[model samples]
Target: MSMPEPKTAWRLLKSAGVKYVRFVIVDIFGRPRVDILPIDEAKDAFIDGVLFDGSSIPAYGGVNRSDFVAMPDLDSVYIETWNGGKTALIFTSVMDGSRPSLRDPRNVLKSALETVKARGYKPLLGVELEFFLVKGDPPMYADGGVYFDGHLLHTWPVLEEIMEHFHLSGIGSTKTHHEVAPGQYEVNIPAGDPLEVADKVLAFKILAKSVAQRHGYTATFMPKPFWGINGSGAHVHLSLWRDGENLFASVKEPREELKYAVAGILQNAIANSVFVAPTVNSYKRLVPHHEAPTRIVWGLGNRSAMVRVPYYGGRINRLEYRHPDPSMNPYVAFASIVFSAYMGVEKRLEPPPPVDTVAYELEGVRETPRHLGDAVKYAQESALLPEEFVKPYLALKEEEWLSYLKSEGDWEKTWNKITRWEYNAYLVNV
Candidate 1:
């Protein structure tokens, strides 16, 4: 479905009985922040914005330059699904007076989408989001169900509610299923324009957790919620379009455009690792034998390859980026991939031979960063992340890594099934 025309947004809200409008925006760390305004004052969003003190937000800005504007994107307006549709939800891009903030994650995605548009193409994105539905407010119990089991019978009520909510929120999901790990589930949100897909990803997480709460369960999207289990990943499926043709689809072999895009993604995988795997716990999920891709390689229908081209043809053909997890900011992560592909198209970069063997078992295959510190060091040396973002992002990630190092003992984290510290830090908070 297309975004509603800006002039009709207010009318639609009123027709839907929206008593309030929630202006939403994500921070550098991908945390959702909001400011609620009465429906009567909603028109002010289109004029300027609802002002807020940005300095108080984590790692956003300081008091000296904290004054900021959150200009709502009317095209993104939707009725709140988890809240009985009583609230109108609209996403915002941070504004420093009249200009978009360079640090805003959503604006970064918009900039990348513009580059694709300039090339006479549009990016289409679909995301597979995975999370755990553990018991307890602090999440001490893992639902006693295995992969693809009849856990559907146990959790179908909540899953059904989630599906209904996704549809009502205008972010329709393609599928929902019991995942590999116990208490883990995967919800596949339908494909859309790059910017909208990112927005929907943020929205889905918020609404999913809220719904889980109402169902007496806490949904956690932490990359590795428990030790020695399958971790959650936000595996992205992407393809480019021009007018009506799928650029990734080829009659034989693969198209030049597809080749160049794959080349760009693989070439920058290590440098862009920090954005793909943003947290300390993210690395815990990236280790070998965990069903997560750790090497920089691509192959047709290969789950072990970092980039997998499914064995399908025609318009449905696309690349599945398997490296990213749910912990990173979807906006930054998706835009970074687009920018890398942009470089590939412009430079006509070539991809290496597709690895037919398991990439992790291959003797000399290149690996993604093994730790947060390693990812930061590699990002520091690369230009994939815009110059404005590197300094602040590096500071934040490095601080997280240091805190992890000082807090956890290697033996306990590996053998004791300890989650008290991790749960307190990330559960329900991130």
Candidate 2:
């Protein structure tokens, strides 16, 4: 949906009996930070924006430039009524004084989208997010269901309630079902504008967690919450359009732009690893034979490949990037994908032949970074993303990797195990 005028949005909220307005901003770590004000005082906030201490947020700004503003995006205005309260939640565009902040994840994505638009292409993004629901202190599975299990009588009600909240919030969820592992579920969000798709992804996480808690369970997006079971992933599907025509459309074989896009992603897959798989536990899910992509390869409808061109044919054809997990910031991850694809088009890069067989059984293929430290190293050495974002992001993630080392010592020794420290650090927080 298009953005309404500020006054019109305020009036809509008031008419809906909204008692409070939530100004939401996503931090670099993909966590939502919110500030709520009564509906009566929200009119001014819509105009002038809300002020907050930016220094408290990681990588936002230092103490010297602590003041930041969150200007509400009217297109993102949605009323959340799941908690038995009328609250209008609006995503914000972060600002520093009179200009946009380079550190803001939303602004970073906007910048990438603008770059793509300048090249006469409109990028579309669809996301499939997988997560798990558990109960108890240490967190055990909430259900014993497997993939596509329809008779989850005890668990289907929770998913139905979550979908109801999504409908109320004006978010589109095309599909919802049990994932491969017990207590794990996947939600498919239809393709749309890149920024809007990212917003929907964030909103999905918030709503899923809220609904889970209300049902006496905890929802987690941690990539590898369990050691033996299948880990969760957030698969991203992308397509390029110009003059209302899909650039990657094809009947049988993939198109040139599609191959170029895949080439670009494979070229920078290692560099983009830190953004897609941001946490220490994320690498555990990337191991060989875990249904996760270990090599930087592309295939035609191959699930094991990092990038796959699903055999949809014609206008619906798109590239599916399978590396990202739910722990990532959608804004940053989407931006990186767009930028990489743009680079491919500009350079006319060609990807290697598509692998029609299992990529996991293949030899002599470039593997993804083994752990968070390796990803950080690759990110530090590469110049694929914006310098402003890469600098501070590496600093924060490097520290996180160091902390893991201090807490768990060597990760290789416990490579096959999910240590207590990992659960303590990432279980619910990620």
Candidate 3:
């Protein structure tokens, strides 16, 4: 079922044992924020929206200054994990009085989805997010179990509780499995409406990690916790449907539209990477092998390709893009996806000749940009994406990168000091 409308959603929250509502929003740096309120304040928040200093949030300051509103998306109201009986969390939409805040990442995505509906297509967007389970206060890699190593593994035995929590919170994930690393695992939700998919991601991250901690361990969504092994992926699965028919599929032997969309994404790959794999740590995961697509190539069933139109279901099926890690703000990620796909629709774009041959060995195809600095530059230079996303997004990230750069030690030395994944996986290669 589609989530309830806001008014009814508000009614349900009032009726529940819900005492305090936390207005949850993600800063431009992908960190979630909360503005807590007592039950008495809920009605005012539900109707008028709560105000805060816009200049304080990363990537949010205006030329002079502006006060922003945090309007609760009431349907997003749910019991926050790890909270005592008094607290509940609700995802928020950024706004200014009656006007929705254009600088808000969530609102930016909502605007993009409006375009999707206007274009007359129902977009099916899904994600498979992977992360690692650890035991330290700071969280460290724990196991060496290859993918699907059952419950016999370490303190990572809380899948049932995690699944149940997701179900009760109204964001049900479709699948959970042990991943290739010892403590790593993945949870997947089936594709549906684009906005809902983004909501599920927001709810899942805060809650899932909270649940993991409840079992006396921490879960890190940091891409690539261990080196040399498979790094984590938020591999995005995309497809199009019009009045109950998949639109990206090929009818006979090949399709032109799929080719166009693939080309468009490749053409925008550098800009897209800034949003998809946002963190400096994220680049460590987007390496040459272990299913990371560092090169801009496409092929059938090849995990290494950035775009894969796998030949699983027959003519004119969906294609999966093997980029995007778990750290992205889902709102921004899905919004850019629809925008890229929209370009495909606009230009009748198509993927390059199916590299039926292996993509790793493919000669002329371009390679994905090398680092976060490179990705940031690409985002600045691209005229294809909405200019709104470009400037604010980069400003947000540059601020974050500057902060991360200020650690006690130097970049060359402390780079791996914070992460052992490179040493564990690619030390020899380096």
Candidate 4:
């Protein structure tokens, strides 16, 4: 069903009775916050927005900050899956009352989307979300099947329940299944314009978790809750479409199609990595042994490559960047991918030929993997991010990085491996 536009959000408030119409938006770390207003106050929030102090949230505005507005974006508005009688869920963009904050993650994504559109192609993003389902508040799924296991059929009942709700909500889900990690699962959603897809992502997560909760279970999209076992990743596959044509389609250059897209993604991938994998825990999922992308390389059907064209090919055909976990803010992450792809297209960057051979066994590229610092440097120095960002990106995560550094064993995170240290401590810690 078509959603009511922002201009009409106020109409919904005026035309219908709403028991609750609160605005929900995520902070820098992808944590959701709500500005709950009585149904009566929501009318003003649609246009004038609900006024709130910006100093309350962590890793956000300064304590002595000025005013910020939660201008509702009805375009992003979604109804929570289990609405009782009077309340509904919607998302908003935090504006400076004059203009949206460029520092705001949502605005950062919008800026990138605008840039890509101006470049002549509309970017389409498809995300393959892999997460786990547990039985309790922390939640666990019914099976222990690992890595493309077929036990998904066992959970079909639960999957069917969730998918039915999504279909009714006009958010189409492409597929769902068991992942490699025990009890881990994945859901693939249909592709759409970046903003629209991001909206679905917000809805998907809420519904996914809520449905699981209702069934006496719990769900987590966190990147690395298990630490050593396989961590979840929201690996996104992207391609450009203009006037109903796939810009990344290999049809025209077939051989070159694969290489060109790969080169472009790698060139801009590092800078965009900031958006794709934003949190400190995100780095923990980047190790080579964990099926994570550690190097700047691409290959066909190789789980280890940073970029891979999954076996399913066509105009809907595209490259999948497997590095991003669920920790990223959907808006920023999607835009970042589009920006990188635009840079790739404009520069006509040619990827090193597809690693027809195994990428792990391939020679010449650096053997050790790249770290988050390596990626931060790339994005920080990139003309794209530097030009559009509101401030030095370094100032963005300094505190979080330093905080993680203070932990006893986490300090050597960048250049060291966790398991390596554990092996060295074996039986000698007495």
How many residue pairs clash (N, CA or C atoms closer than 3 angstroms) in each of the candidate models, in the order given?
0, 0, 12, 10
* lDDT winner: 2
Question: Which one wins by lDDT: 3 or 4?
Answer: 3
**What lDDT score belongs to each candidate, Candidate 1 first?**
0.81, 0.88, 0.71, 0.66
Winner of 1 and 3 under lDDT? 1
- Candidates in order, TM-scores: namely 0.93, 0.97, 0.88, 0.84
Q: Which parts of model 4 have CA positions greater than 4 angstroms off?
A: 1-7, 10-18, 58-60, 135-142, 147-158, 251-259, 311-316, 366-378, 386-393, 410-430
249-280 per-residue lDDT for model 4 (tens digits): 75323344345656777776666776787655
After superposition, which runs of candidate 1 have C-alpha atoms over 4 Å from their true positions? 1-7, 137-142, 313-316, 409-419
User: Is candidate 1 or 4 superior in lDDT?
Assistant: 1
lDDT of 3 at 150: 66
Residue ranges of candidate 3 with Cα displaced over 4 Å:
1-8, 62-64, 81-87, 137-139, 250-254, 313-316, 383-385, 399-430
lDDT of 2 by residue, 1-430 (tens): 5668788888888988899998998898878899999998999898888899999999888899899999999888767867654887899999988888878999989999989999899999998899999888677888999889988887788999998888777887467889999999998877999999988888888788889888888889989988889999999999999999998888787889888889999999999999999999999999877789998899888899999888854333799999999999888899999999988987999999899898998899899998999999998888466788779989999999899888888878876788788888878886
Q: Which 10 residues in a row give candidate 2 its minimum summed lDDT?
A: 308-317
**Model 2 TM-score, 2 decimals:** 0.97
Q: Which candidate tops TM-score? A: 2
Candidate 3 per-residue lDDT over residues 1-430, each given as its tens digit: 5667656666676677677887887676456778888877766777767778877786666647767778777656667544544567788888766777666778877888788778787778888888777776445566666677765445545677777777766676577888877777889866877777777776777776777777876667777666667777888888877788777777545466567777777777877888888876777677665778877877777677898776765555777888888877777777787778768876887666666655666676787766666778787877344566568878766765565555433445544334543333221110
User: What TM-score does structure 1 among the candidates reach?
Assistant: 0.93
Query: In model 2, which runs have C-alpha deviations exceeding 4 angstroms?
Result: 312-316
